[model samples]
Target: MGIVTSLLPFSIRCEPDGDVLCAHLAKGNRQIDELREQPPTSVLFHGPQGYVSPSWYATKREHGRVVPTWNFVVVQVWGTPTIRDDVQWLREQIEELTNAAEKGFRMPWKVADAPEDFIQAQMKGIVGLEIPVSRIEGKRKLSQNQPDRNQAGVIAGLRETGQEALADAVAEGRRQPDDFSLAK
Candidate 1:
């Protein structure tokens, strides 16, 4: 099978019922076709990621040996995707996804807010996906290999540049046990 990749918006929820990843794609999307043809697929979720300049490392000043690197957190999930065209299932998937995405807003929007016929028409133009995750891997590269002083410098630099999420990840990485590996 050929490799096919598509950037899709998705959500994951784990509950007693089941743990599944959900996403919707426009009707006739090639990625959906590929998934139907080749059941096995991998979904990559990207977390905070950014460039870390060598200047952010304290060792850069000590010996000019530091090189630029990227700091990021990402998760890869492998599974066979199941496509759903049932309107009810699609509606529930979209509503749940919308609710999660809008939770932080003071005035959240609901799928029900739209006209019933309009919502039905929209749903017809899309398909829902359910991926039962089989294997998962995560990686966090956050200056974990650097000295404590260098890590602190990286955090300060990231924060100074308004990369708060990445800065926070770097701080969290330092709190991990000494035996913690960058990838798991």
Candidate 2:
């Protein structure tokens, strides 16, 4: 499978259903057109990422040889797309997506927030997509190449810059060395 398109307009929301990964798109979305024409495709999700300065390395003062790099987490999913144009399916997909995205809110929004007729009219403009996932690849690049002391220094620098999330990610990576791997 090759890239159908990147940076598609809508934020792609996907969930696993049995062996398949389901995604939702609008009726006129370019991805929908591409998926219809070419079913084989990939969906990539980029998680937290940050720049790591050479100064953050504990070894920088020793040899002054360290170079800047980046740390990140990413996931790639490959599959063949199957379009779902059913009105009921689109409604259900919209409701589920809305619910999941709004879960953190004090009072989450629901599809029922709008009038039934209004929602029905809106649902007509969308479509559902089901991809039977063939493979999945994930990577977590969080200063794993550095020694323990250097990694700690990087984490400290990150926390100083109010990047606690990235710092925590690096710390977590250090803790679970065997869990996160680039290998399939």
Candidate 3:
């Protein structure tokens, strides 16, 4: 409950392979309905993102005017999530997550200083999640369907727009097959 709220932002990758999901409000005491929580084992997270122009889509070149499309990266982890009621563990997890998230921020939230009534009330809303992951699916749909030239162009555009990682991921995505084979 405490750690996650106090720690600065940290990337929580699903086990070994899934992509990093977006930041979650780690207040252990936050309500379930108020959270966008998923099954503990569900590996899902996304961070900063932006829209990708239809101009980047490989299918766009043929059409003079095409609908705009977005390019983004997603990580999915499929697994069962377990909730923990241990107060100490919940507080520790919260604290860890919080410290990891708030490194740069001047004003950080603390669990200790929070009103006991308010905090206690928040307890029911929060429960620790134990996600034992099973399968991982990572997708970075940048623009792999296009020719090398077009891909290069898209990558350049993403980099120019300060989306280098996405550009690289998308560029590489074009070459990768959906299913893995013994030989690369």
Q: How many clashes (backbone N, Cα, C below 3 Å) per candidate?
A: 0, 0, 30
The model with the greater lDDT, 2 or 3, is 2
Candidate achieving the largest TM-score: 1
TM-score winner, 1 or 3: 1
> Lowest-lDDT window of 10 residues in candidate 1?
175-184
Q: Write the per-residue lDDT of candidate 2 for residues 38-129, one digit (tens) a residue.
A: 46677777777899999988799889889999998887777788788988877776777677789999999899989999998887887788
TM agreement with the true structure for every prediction = 0.90, 0.85, 0.57
Residue-by-residue lDDT tens digits, candidate 3, 1-184: 2212222243454545543332223444453332335434344455334566657545466665555556666755555544557777666666667666667788877677777778667765655655455566666655555567667767777788998777777766787754331210
* Cα lDDT of model 1 by residue, 69-149, tens digit: 998888788777988888988999899989998999999999999999999999999999888776777888889899999
Q: How does residue 75 of candidate 1 score in lDDT?
A: 78
State residue 79's C-alpha deviation in candidate 2, in Å. 1.0
Clashing pairs in 2: none
**For this target, which candidate reaches the highest lDDT against the unseen true structure?**
1
